[model samples]
Target: MSQTETNRRLITELQSRGLRLLDESAGAPSRRGGAGPSDHKAVQINGQTVMVPVHSRSAAVSPFEAGASGANGAVQLTRDGAHVGDIRFPEAPRFYGLQTLDGVPYWKIAQLHGTDVLATTVLQTCVRYGRRDTSCQFCAIGESLAAGRTINRKLPEHLAEVARAAVRMDGVRHMVMTTGTPNFTDRGAALLCESAFAVRAAVDIPIQAQCEPPDDPVWFDRLKAAGVDSLGMHLEAVTPEVRARIMPGKAEADVEQYMAAFADAVAVFGRGQVSTYILAGLGDSASAILETSERLIALGVYPFVVPFVPVGGTPLAEHPPPDAAFMRSILQPLGRMLAEAGLRARDIKAGCGRCGACSSLSTYED
Candidate 1:
């Protein structure tokens, strides 16, 4: 097959496989059944168990290195024309072996993203984490809590110590800090600013923070002034119907509110420096996602679209991912728009938009 034909085929299979994976993970009380304890990160996809990353803040263990068996899983992967492993295991972060003066665990506060980026949720609990009906169905922020893997809130000192350790010890090149929604008026953005400033006091690594829009748009300036280099405000699913069903509590805040937030954020962060995650496979139409992408690009915002990776214990684990054809259909065209808008990912200072490795949108953008 020609190169284009090969990529097209690969994209299709990835979507189908991702969708099939989600379906098997949902409906069960947990993604793993009859599998006993199972190391907390083993998940089954259509009876074929696979090891997936489990986020934690207190311990320094590679959930990937401890993954359960999946010899039956597919392994043919296409990356830069080389067929490689379907999912390579992420190495343990180099900083995991350290701790703070108070004996606080370094690995417990921050974890590695991809290979070089250190990422963490500044606060582990969300106002909605306690409410099932209003919860963002796919989120597992509370899962680690039940497992005793993190504290309810991460102190600024904890973030600072861990941030410095990740960069100094692990050679981390970038950092990202996010937080759960607070009942407070600023939607958790201000807390992110606080965390960023704390980290900035010790290190010079580029940092990105994600949060919902604040009632006061000026907090965007505060976040930037505090040394946050980029921003992410995820619009997980675009259409109102899917959002209402998938992220009920967050959906209560409408797209217009998010758009206004993005607009103000772009003014401070500038062009590609601001981003929003548009997750695929939550049952939104491909056209709707592309429509949202076009709108975001017009506003000079990078719409970083990623295929939804269902958490094993989440409510929608059984929901299938959108097929590969669906992903490319939206991404290829949208990638063109990103190029036309001169909103390239390379321009983003930090976070997922710059990483572009998690989603195949970067593939299409190529």
Candidate 2:
């Protein structure tokens, strides 16, 4: 195929498999994506949900074919967006080179997100992860735990050790530390703060931390004071029914708790710094997700919408991802709302939004 033909085929193939460019412009919310209420192609390949172009039917091709990327589609060409060259992976920085005298792999502890940001989940196991009624259906938090890939929790000092190495050794510019829920009064937020403060003392990299909204909104201020520059309070689903079904334990907090937490986070982290994830295809409608997003934007919080990609071996294992067209439909209206609020994903200082990986919301915003 000609290079242009090869590129077009590559885009079609990737879209057929639910992948798209991460940065916005051509396949934007209002453009060719499903956000328009127009029919977009969908298929089940090997039982996984995929969003195909309306005219094509196939699985994904290698990302190397076009200027597209593997993680987020940052370089996919769309008609309206800026024609920036493809965004490429940041090289493994020097910090990934060093290890403590103990010989624990530094990259294994925490790794860079996207190009330059360091991200780690210090505590990777959730209390009710495997239990039938307590786990978040969408989370694979304990998948690595089951395979002995990570410890249930890492000590503040251990986390600090890796954080320092990542900064001084790697060209890492920002940091994000997250944890599974701990059965403590601090709800694991306190431990994240301790680690953040330690990393701050060692390097000048800004940090972002995520956790379940603590029992008290006051903890948001505590995290900010402890050198955490941004916050991610994830509400994976929008409606209460979906939340309860997908994340029974998290749903226990109630929507009111989440709203209150968002208000508190905005107060401490400022507008555009606070973020929440709202997964698509989880039994909620496009209107429902966008309506919630609109309300969130009004309160200076970002609705980081993502397509529900069913990770292997979770309770939702048998479940399928939402078709890509549905994700496009939801993102279009919501992206507009976010744009009007001036809540560009890049404006998020740290975490998933800034990395622009894990979801296509950033592309929609484009």
TM-score of 1: 0.80
Off by over 4 Å in 1: 1-90
Which candidate leads in TM-score? 1
Q: Estimated TM-score per prediction?
A: 0.80, 0.76
The window of 10 residues in a row where model 1 has the poorest summed lDDT is 30-39
Predicted candidate 2 versus true structure: per-residue lDDT over 1-366, tens digit per residue: 575433333332344243333432222121121111111222222222223323212112212222344465344333234342342323345776677677766665776554466767877766777586888876777655566544566666667788777666666677778888876466788888888887777667778898888878788888998988888888888898999898888888887788888988898899989888787778998988888888888889888776565555566644655665676677667767777778997777777677654455555564
Judge candidate 1 against the unseen true structure and give its global Cα lDDT, from 0 to 1: 0.68
lDDT of 1 by residue, 101-143 (tens): 8876776677665556777878777888667798888787876
Query: 176 in model 2: Cα distance from truth in Å?
Result: 1.4
Per-candidate Cα lDDT values, in order, are: 0.68, 0.64
Model 2 CA lDDT for position 232 = 85
In candidate 2 the C-alpha lDDT for residue 227 amounts to 88
State candidate 2's TM-score: 0.76
